[model samples]
Target: MKNTLSRLKYLYRKASRAGADYYNAPYRAAIARARREEDDLFMLLVFSEMMGIPNPAGWYCMELQPLMLERFHDWHTRMGMERSPLDNFRCC
Candidate 1:
């Protein structure tokens, strides 16, 4: 009886997971696109000064440099940049 209960519980969990995935599948792509756009905007906000765009929050954004530098390469590539846009920071 215990063994059967365990098996039933496992199947119930699996089915619930499958149902959740199916329900979320349609919104996944849209969520991903929105997240990408959001990241792009964030990168722009953080690196606007280096990109020749004057940013009002430049001072505040500077604090994010250390945290964001690691993602610089991916961000620039996605933005169609062949190389880093900042003269001071080269992220190939």
Candidate 2:
């Protein structure tokens, strides 16, 4: 009886997870797009100085450069630039 109850509980949990995933499938693409846009905005904020844009939070954003540099190439390309916008930094 204990084993049967445990098995039933496991099945119930599995079914719940599957159901949730199925329900969320339609919105998955929208969620992914929104997340990507948010990241792109964050990258822009971090690299705004390099792109010739004056960043109001430049002092605070300076600390984030090293961490965000790796994604700089992708971000600039996505923004329709053929090459790195920064004269000092070239990635591509």
Candidate 3:
């Protein structure tokens, strides 16, 4: 009887996890997409000057470049670009 109860508890835990995952899948996906969009916007703000668009806050945004350096490569790749147009900070 003890063995049967333990097995039932294990099965219940497994089912609970599966149900939670199913319910949270859409929220997880939406969060991921929102993060991606936010990242893209941040990159644009930081590199607008390179793209020939004069950003009023370009000077201020420059300070964030170093912090965002690690994501530069992934950002460009996600944009489906072969290379970053900014020559000074190549992420390819």
8-58, model 1: which lDDT tens digit per residue? 999999999999999999999999999989998998999888878999999
Top of the candidates by lDDT: 1
Q: Which stretches of candidate 2 lie over 4 Å from their true place?
A: none
lDDT of 2 at 20: 99
> Which of 1 and 2 is ahead in TM-score?
2
Q: Provide the overall lDDT of each model, using Cα atoms, as 2-decimal numbers.
A: 0.91, 0.89, 0.88
Report clash pairs, candidate 3: none
Which model scores highest in TM-score? 2
Q: For residues 24-44, could you state the per-residue lDDT of candidate 2 as single tens digits?
A: 999999998999899999988
- Model 3 over residues 23-50: C-alpha lDDT tens digits? 8887997998998999899898898887
Model 3: per-residue Cα lDDT at residue 55: 97
Error of 2 at 12 (Å): 2.8
Q: Name the better of 1 and 2 by lDDT.
A: 1
lDDT of 3 at 38: 94
lDDT of 3 at 19: 100
- Tell me the TM-score of each prediction against the true structure: 0.74, 0.78, 0.68
